[model samples]
Target: MTDTQEHTWGERYADSLMNTFGQPKLVLTRGAGAHVWDTDGKEYVDLLGGIAVNALGHAHPALVEAVTAQLGTLGHISNFFASEPQVRLAEKLLALLDAGPGKVFFTNSGAEANEAAFKLTRRTGRTHVVAAQGGFHGRTMGALALTSKEAYRAPFEPLPGDVTFVPYGDAEALAAAVTDRTAAILLEPMQGEAGVVTPPKGYLAAARTIADEHGALLWLDEIQTGLGRTGRWFAHHSAGVTPDIVTVAKGLAGGIPIGACIGVGESGTLLEPGNHGTTFGGNPVACAAALAVIGTIETDGLLEHVTALGQKLRDGLAADPRVTEVRGEGLLIGLDLAAEVSAAVTAGALAHGFIINNPTPHRIRLAPPLVLTQDDAEAFLTAWPAILDEAFEGQS
Candidate 1:
């Protein structure tokens, strides 16, 4: 296709779609594994993996077969009735957590999962939640209230009130803010939207202790870092603390749009009858897709692959002096640039037939598919120097 053809689609998209996402970067036609082809037939290595949602990569046979088979058999059966896949998925998630007895409430997205958790916290007879600054939970009103970003929160004021924000990774700050009145102390094992910022060692353990001290629920939003993205079933696994509440989505269903809010131990009984509900929450097809994703991760040994590849990518990317820092675990990688050229770097990367993301002016994040090949990783590493050269062409 010609440039005009692409421009026509862009114009049509602007007219037809909402302006929430600004503009579509490319008119992607199809994808296989870690590669995608644009309408122009240009192939690019997909490093963002649909913003960390495509755990098994594009069009994996397991995910495709599971979704197709389930849809053909039984697709949507509202929450009024239960399905085998739904119950099995809930059990699988609990087994993965291995955090004693727990109950799962399914949703269609991460925001909905956090919303359910927010309401569950209210069941404890408290409304005050102390969430860390720089944490990105979700965009729903309740999740938005838990998020500390002023810009995202400012647009919708009078949000569920009494949510306190404290500096991330600071045990003293968290301890000072949480009290008996606090219902939950929410933290992301690793801040994804905030350029994949990671907390200090023992930060989550500290948060667990603080929450316990105040009798508050420890809620970890593992939306971005969970499901093998961090080389573990859950990012909080490394901290060795059992949280009362856990919210997960993103890669849960390998891009089939599923989220879960898991309440542990006594917290599971807080939300009794007539508490909350969803129409399309636990549909059989989505549940099957999630089960397939988990099965593949285990059978294919993708967690070990993610751990090794993540380290390689981090090391290779950090070889350049322009890269000031590298953070995150497993396939979720983020690096800082010495200069404010992340936009230029992203553009340069695209021109070189690789897709990357610039979350901030000086930060780039890469959450590639767990199935990303060693060849693709080497390709990106080999092109790293030249890409930076183009991005920093006119810089000091």
Candidate 2:
């Protein structure tokens, strides 16, 4: 069954799908907890966790049940009338962020979340925004403007303007870039796409001070680091600075696709009615899914679990001489190999019943679900050397 289906599915995917994402690496059939079964019934530990979107692993009972129940009850209200889940989810995001007096603007993804936040910043009557180098907010026009990658920006020229890029984790650079005309200073508490680059200590606090000094809003993109993914409700919490605007998505709905743009204090009321809108932003099902994701996080005590498991993973991965360094917190782990075999390592892991990501030439990223087990961590640790051996031999 496996052999017969594998070849056919692979061929069909190549023939039918767009060439944008290269090839369909695997046609996954089903998932449960931290594992997924491919079209050919080969199972792999999904350490990537849908690129940190699957907060509750795959097909968690609570997520399925909540989404199912909400869809049946009140699925879409067209944004003309709000539902319980929408309001509750917004309030929940504010509470988790622990910022006082905020409002949430829902979106379908991280890109849209930034779009909404970008629009809100315009309401400050200032057009300028300062963001960090090595930052990735999203790919939409507005968010892409804030993103610093030259290749991504060069192709999509004439993006929405009045944007400046400065070095990340340098408060002095940020201060130099910002001014009274700046509407907001955008940052990621941890730059995930830059291979899990954690900012220097006191950076967020410094941003907060700088924003205040220049009468600009401090905006933090927590899309990749929120919802206990970093062993905290929001990664900025560890920095102990309050950001006026926060964008979140990724793991909020356990793969259901939802994002929120939160504006704190006076920033919450910056966008008046008719300032911006969305079609499916705060749909009930998505909010219910987010509720279920957050509920499960609290019920499972997964925060402590992630913190403990992360230390274990970092220690284990760093023990390998081939692994030069390990970075990130909680389940958002990244490591740099001594050689440029990240692509080979990614392929080797898939062949060895594990799924991980190679975000760069020399970097491997592991963002397993909060539900990833001690045994899975230990298994990966035990197989680290063998995986490296295979990667080197295969790529050599």
Candidate 3:
């Protein structure tokens, strides 16, 4: 947009909207490929990729076509008459998991997906859910009960109950906490919000075995890590475990709001009719968008692309002494700084025409679009030390 249009947006945004996310960094006007332009015509290499939602990057033709065609033909039909795209998305997701005999319940966001799974666990004739500390489930009441962050939970108290917290990636603690009374053990294969922490080898297998021994369902939340973002359809697949329930969203629809809770084996049938219902959960447009995303991933071999690029990024970032550690697989990477300079780094990156996330004081996270190119990753690497220098320049 022109300068006048940009200023108008700044004024209007300040006048309206809540202060929940602080001041708008830039009024983004358009996006394409790995870049987005703000209203002021400044462009940024979107390393964070809208918190990992833009898997195919911005304005990919396949995604746009799928969404447009589906919207033109059939849009929101409610949940009474099932849409082809919705059914196809479920079938496609099941195929990706390679888990048999599963049923899916769709929602509009990751949290809602978790919300559906939370209630589904309750239907297993058990009310207890065991989750990991430093885990992020979601913000809604039911999902929030399973989330571990005190700050996010404290403000929304009196949440749905029967949740127990244990240390993440600790199988022994999970085994001890999950009794027969527990309906499910929910986990993120790689902790996204807690700086991309992956569990030790065999941790998920152990969790699966423990759940089996206790007759509790094993649930994997792949909201931030699914849809080929981590070089696999689900990050837990690397653990070689078949979880009874899996909740996915985020990149599922390549930015279209969509989420799903799928239960495998007999666990799929817990939620009976009238148990839960949503007016706009399985809308056609969202499902079509997801189908396009999946198709593009397969056709473009984006999974392999992510694996290669992620390693390049990790290797480059870890070469700096100030970067204490880099943890993650594929494009979902997180790094620890030598000092509590993550916030400064994030601000510095933005100023340098790049985008990243500071999930914790001493840690930075990057869930860039799986389609992030080698050139982009290399450019970031070239700028890495300088970014850190800028971040550290004025520190106390």
What are the root-mean-square deviations of the candidates from the true structure over C-alphas? 0.8, 1.3, 1.3
**Weakest lDDT window of 10 consecutive positions for candidate 1:** 387-396
Candidate 3 overall Cα lDDT vs. reference?
A: 0.91
Q: Please report the candidate that would top lDDT against the real structure.
A: 1
lDDT minimum window of 10 residues, candidate 2: 1-10
Weakest lDDT window of 10 consecutive positions for candidate 3: 17-26
lDDT string for model 3 (1-396, tens) is 678887788788878988778787788879998899987789899998889899999999999999999989999999989989999999999999998889999999999999999889888889999999999988888889999899999998888878899999888899999997999999999999999998899999999999999999999999999889899988988888899999999999999999999989887899999999999898999999999999999999999999989998999999999999999999999999999999999999998889999999999999888778888888889999999998887686
Candidate 3 scores a C-alpha RMSD against the true structure in Å of 1.3
lDDT of each: 0.94, 0.92, 0.91
Query: Once superposed on the true structure, which residue ranges of model 1 sit more than 4 Å away at CA?
Result: none
lDDT of 1 by residue, 242-313 (tens): 999999999999899899999999988888879999999988999999999999999999999999999999
Q: Give the TM-score of candidate 2.
A: 0.97
Residue 28, model 2, lDDT = 91
TM-scores, all models, native as reference: 0.99, 0.97, 0.97
Which of the predicted structures, 1 or 3, would earn the higher TM-score when compared with the native? 1
Q: What is the full ranking by TM-score, best candidate first? A: 1, 3, 2
lDDT of 3 at 50: 89
